[model samples]
Target: MKDDKKTDKPLKRQETEKTQQLAEHTADSTGELMNTNHGVRINDDQNSLKAGERGSSLLEDFILREKITHFDHERIPERVVHARGSGAHGVFKAYKSMSGVTRAHFLSDESLETPVFVRFSTVAGSRGSTDLARDVRGFAVKFYTQEGNFDLVGNNMPVFFIQDAIKFPDLVHAVKPEPDNEMPQAASAHDTFWDFISLMPESAHMIMWLMSDRAIPRSYRMMEGFGVHTFRFVNAEGVSNFVKFHWKPLLGVHSVAWDEAQNISGKDPDYHRRDLWDAIESGNFPEWELGVQIVPEEDEFKFDFDLLDSTKIIPEELVPVQRIGKLTLNRNPDNFFAETEQSAFHIGHVVPGIDFTNDPLLQGRLFSYTDTQLIRLGGPNFQEIPINRPIVPVHNNQRDGYMRQTINRGKSSYNPNSLGNGYPLQAKASEGGFTSYPERIDAKKIRARSRSFFDHFSQAQLFYNSQSDPERNHMIDAFSFELGKVQSVEVRQRMLGILSLVDKGLAAAVAFALRIPVPQDPELPVNHSIPADGNLADYDPFTVDTALKASAALSMANTVKDTIKTRKIAFLAADGVDEKSLTTVKAALEGAGAIVEIISPRLNFILSEGDEQIPVNHSLLTAASVFYDAVYVPGGTNSVATIEAEADAVHFLNEAFKHCKAIAADLGAAQVLEATYFSKKIPSEFSDQTVLREGIVVGEDPKKLADQLILAISQHRFWEREKPRKVPA
Candidate 1:
């Protein structure tokens, strides 16, 4: 619950701290005299001290020795997961005061625009791996709130592959490149992954999300993000509620085809990284509304799924998300290594109003994060690294450790001391000090999981049942493609058995792709994950029937499609191009906020029929249609003939068509389209409905053609055309 009104407090610190911090780091470095680490300036930096001009160097050359030593040890250990990442500087502003639900200053005050640093990453990849890998994206945000730092560390997918954190290592080891050969770099198509998934029934729900188009997002700006664990929001009145966090992209949830994702990996491994950087540079800042789903503490066990299970979701149908704030990433990082790479996030980093739940996975992460940072950052003082530091001053009685940046004077490093007059005093809960909720716990200690976390397939079934036909087909193809890469026949069959438990038709589709029959009893290895002490006959995975058969929010097909903002559209034109048609359509698309890039036979520029020099964004040799949202060909006698004759140009259109993107051509340029394979397969009649379904726009008037193409682009893709009009590139 929020107050829906502004707070009385002023926001001077929240609004200006971001710029002040950036200035503190960068402004001091400007015009600084070159000096060594000891603040000694050396004039002879070019050469080391030597006995003579051509003699051997002496050990007394401190400048050269220091420079070389520093360069050799500059690198720190990378993160174990989410190693490949892109970060940006942003701000988050609450839409209204949420004082009714929480006392966290940032959320309770609507006037404050809190500074935040966000990092988006790929989970299974290394620092040098491609950004287009089909893996979960880490969507972590660090809010420099007035009280302290709050890191909303989460992922693009709402559910996880395991219910407990103990199985986290196993999951990662299976998905990572195999230890022996390490043949695959950043993929999960190998046997180890399927073998692990086949045994862990809890993985079924997350596997469905991984196999869907959600794995290959169109851009970092177009994907949805979710906090995968349930948390507690405690109000000042001593009331609590179970809360889930969400980040809904203003650009809407959209994704690339699996085929297109593979092509992008080859064409540009840093596609997402580049997209985020270029958008911020071009002033098209990426935006997402911060959303949350809150269920009263009394209603926690009212749902079929357990609230404490990380693998389960509180389907939006049960508790609708309330968009509470807006997050806008308007600035790119100043330095990649110092700002983006060194930044640290932790799930345990929270203010007073927020607290943890008994979620097993979450409880484990609270310990793992600090330990991981200590090893990776070289010290416990990693928070002093500016990027990870909060806006408010940090005061503590703890003494220095490795790489300690703070200098303390006076005795009394311990609390309750008469000397130093009891400095650095602690605050009470009434005075904004952090405190955990006092929930009574009287249960006995046990190493067993609750039976409530056993019903794993209902939500998985709910997810599969919610997908549209095109999305379902894509998932089927994804499973077939990935399982086909798995070498072990037994692993494939075991996975198929698990799939059958979710849905028969799904298993049949993938089994047919692998040229195998579906298993009669799909629950063959259901007890494979049981512990050694557990009885095989007693192992049972509860199956709870979901009251809801499907949820519209689970499918990307029902996402927002009213705008084509920031959509990249390619214009395939060459010498003697029709200036009127090309310029008119480009203006129209650009006016509607779409990015129009001209791709011709060669780079730099092209000649129009009116002898006007038209600039080209890229050449066909360098530009691939997979990098664009749509493709268009304008009419001109010479231009059309040249384009049709050029094999690469024709291939561009064909590949775009194959990827299910919108395509268009002027009526006079119809021959250019005919040169492609699918031109004859689609409807010849140019009815608006027929044209819309096929994602092909053809009209004599430039304005009319532009309008039709805009509509097609807004639809994101014509996925239905993919199955019937499969074309060659």
Candidate 2:
């Protein structure tokens, strides 16, 4: 069989042309003369046409009016949520045919490459907000398949904050900046958010995720994405099964420390965005394994949690994900607004095999996405936008809306008309036309939730129990920090009460930090969002003691830690640095797929021991330890002394140590290590085991040090060092 892998084959012209259509609207004026919007050459663009040099501009100056009018109306309405986002172009290919499970062409065809556009974003943040906000990330992917566009609109976390779509608005309103003051932008550490969360027990499971390390991702390329809701996959025979989507990054899931995340937000507000753009630009394409947890329709009720509940997750232990395909993002968008910003994703955009379940939240989004695009993208016809257009031809009776790019020529615009001879007729299911699963329903309409969704604290407890020691500590610290920011005593106390349901120790830790007594007997049957006519006793959440105490998959500590690809390593050096030690280590890291940057006392160039000018990528004044994944100090007689004397260099190493990042130095640079605040905490011997455990290496052999540093960086971070040997950088 011919190989269908994108890496093995050249990009097809059709795919290039699809993207090029948008490129035609783009222009670069590097060597071109200035011209008006109409392409007319301008003799005096700097000065508008006027009666005199300083006199009022003439009203007849079409150039001036056109320029100002275009500038004035350049902005579009940003997304109400997930306003800050970065997108990339890519292709998805199935590893093998999934025809037995689903009839979706993209999933069943192994030879086809489906064009895709993925947008990574942070929820609760506006277009101008910082990317490091501790919140859920929007991981929506638009797959332009032969059948149509299938949008797997998801979030980084597997669950949401609410069970039903009815509470979505209330959840967003509370998490957003207070309407009165509009304060605490892109943050959920305020009283309003906690007040709402404390009242709604259904949000407990999602809150655990929000407070965990997953909320603060190191980079968009290093995080995981989930479809959040349980969808349905129907085979050609009309057999249906429950399915959940997952995107597991090939780079492994990793995250920055909460403190480091805050520092990054201040240092570079566009940290995640820049990281993704730079990775693709440098040819380190980000890739993810598409996985699905398929649950037989009959077995869905076997789980303790409700499959329809958006706030629960079917643990990996219960249903292991089957890795069936790959999604590679190889190209960055050319224009941010034209492509990335204008892109629209809808949960309802499913093809033949892919169908929706009765998930309340998913049902609500089916209506919300199209309604939002109607106003946000300017009327209805948003799918016609180049970035959003499907690969297949779109032919329908509907036409002529705002921003109508297609000029249709037909005598009849409606169906059942002989004037056009039924030209744009619909296709049958056998002909690749979509057909919704004929799900039977026989029940009275009511405003209520299933009794199965009443047990909300079980998964929350499982999540807390599954975390590693260091992860648990981080969660405690996170809850403490967030609650400490809450000004309302009532909200803080109530949140502590809610936390107690998940874990008593976690609640006690936050209570101690807040200097408030934990409420011994807080409100039971807590669900303030229950319907007005509903029975409070029946609506109260029940804490189920799940058979599984913990699932290792819930913790990031168990994530892949075998490669350091795309990791940024900063080489600390100075004038008269040992050229051999610097060059050898730099080569080893670069060869390992790690990006190496030279940092010295000053930018431009630094003289090495051989008197060769080594270019510096960043200076001590401009670079921060938080910007790199690891730190290395090369050796030199004068270089060690100069770096030792530089307080910023000493603090750089110390800060890296504080954040549990790998730190390496040549034996000759002992003086430099000794100058740092963390030097005294280093172990006496540098054994192979100790080096890996401590994430600190000091040796004479350049090659050995470089190899050990590569292994240390692959571990991501030495989180074990955070609490035991905490230091003041």
Candidate 3:
């Protein structure tokens, strides 16, 4: 077994030729002349060949025709779901062999670094939707292993909104823009969505996740990912074990406040996308630990909830995750359209040792993915796309489809043809050929769900009870915000009843906000997707009380908050700034992997105490506090006066404080803080405990202020101040 504590290094491409092969398609047009699609050097690309100076373009102008035609066909059909996305190239290396659990080469070979491409996306958004939508985020990873490509198609949340795939269409349609007017794009806060959700009790657990801080992640690098279905791992001995995959980010889970998320959407709609690209380019590679919870087949039914139920999770307390591998995303895609957009992921894509279970959701996705790809990618040969191609050589009888790139020379394409002498013979099991697990199954053909999958409210309660006070409050506020947008009073009342099942306090809170009474007994057997012939008694969901009430793993407040790496901090200053104080704090922050940018009242440069010109990253007019993780104000007689006078500068501090972000100011710059709305709430004295509790650091000494600021920033936020004191930006 490889050493678990060994530091992971960047993957070297010298071990495989696949990375180099992709380079051939990568184009850099630096210092290059414009050319046509045929690579013909063009000297007059600015203007098309015209009859005289002002006439219609000639039909003979192949350049114009080719350019226009290519441009017209550039866009392919966006995905029905997860339409907006960002992708990156990376490598996955196992920490130790997992031969006992499975025979998968990538998991059993510690030395091999498998190439991978991962795409992060919003589930219900369009190609142009905001990244801050309060919706589920898809976290799909495609591993280009020598055995073949394995796609772990998953989401940021461990559970999903629906148990069966049949309800997927209805769920999406309800959350998407209303069909009549197409209003409320990329949001679930609408009448249709609440109406659908209020009737679907299976969505209770997932709705808690959506309304929690998990829905609006701070960045893609700081979120936990999970394969929402239970899969099977087959060993060399033909032994099978049920598995649930997880990706625990190294940076830990974090999120922005709902109000801050709204502001960020307006300030930078591509916030997460830009952050990912910037992090990779700046050498701050994002990483995650690939973990798995393995349960013996005999122990599957030991859980209160069914393993096959997509809306439930095998809590970590019951089955702890064994993190056996590290996945590092070190390279950004060369082209968004050619790589990120073209990449295809399906849960059915698996290597030897990895196989599917009888999960109804997983079984349906196997058919849905292939069918969706056929229409969206324009053919069955979409795997031939450069981004989706496997590293291993593919040999098959299938050939000739739309946009087919392979050229075959054979007399027979059939499997049992003597003319070709069975040249493309299939490999035996010993030769790494995939063999499905030989599990016996004897069941009558039926459309009804299993009785074991009926429990829905237990895990939902567990998730709610597990959250920290701040997280719980945020969830309560989120429910209020979403249900408030709902137009139907009946839908709101029904949802409040569902909330009552999870927690009465949560239900009453949302009811108070919505100005509606929480019904003593709203309704039962709220499932609307049941078969017409099905008896309501058989379909009634059970409320199994789990042995463990609260799982620490369910709370984001318990996540790692010891590092401030890659955090962006803004230094508010202007003309005649204190150079000593500004540079001292900047050096300390940058030394700790924190990015420090100078923001002044004007663009270009700011004048220091010695009349030295100091460059500024952005002016207060263009930059907002929403774009940064924290705010710092350096002392300067003229700088502090200018910032105090500037309304935008004062608003920046106020907004940052209102968002519960860390704020630090020099003693000299206290006047500037006093101008902000939250200044009166600032404590009279500053201490280490006060700095941590309040998330505000102020000191006369630059070094001391910097030290306190670092500590405060690591805490991520001081949400305690949000409810007690609200500021208007």
Q: lDDT per residue, candidate 2, 632-699, as tens digits? A: 99989988889999999999999999999999988888778778788678754443323535788877
What is the model-wide C-alpha lDDT for candidate 2?
A: 0.89
All-Cα superposition RMSD per candidate = 2.7, 2.8, 3.3
TM-score of 2: 0.96
TM-score per prediction, in order, is 0.96, 0.96, 0.96
* lDDT for position 383 in model 3: 93
Q: Residue by residue across 1-729, what tens digits does model 1's lDDT show? A: 112322333555665775687668774557877789999986877888898999999998889899999999899888999999999998899999888889888998778888899999999979999988989999999998877899999999999999888888899999999999986888989999989999988999999999999999999999999989999998888789889999999989999999899999999999999999999999999999999999998998898879999999988988999999999999998889988999999999999899999999999999989999999999899998889888777888877888897798889888888898997778777677888888889999888788788787899999999999999999999999999999999889889989988999999999999998888876554846677787655455636776799999999999989888999999999999999989999999999999999999888999999999999999989999999999989989999999999999989999999999999988878888888888788665553323545688887788988988998999999899889889877
Candidate 3: worst 10 consecutive residues by lDDT?
Answer: 1-10
Q: Between prediction 1 and prediction 3, which has the larger TM-score?
A: 1
lDDT of each: 0.89, 0.89, 0.89
lDDT measured at residue 289 in model 3 versus the true structure, 0 to 100:
99
Q: Compute the lDDT of residue 253 as modeled in candidate 3.
A: 94
- Residue pairs that clash (backbone atoms under 3 angstroms), model 3: none
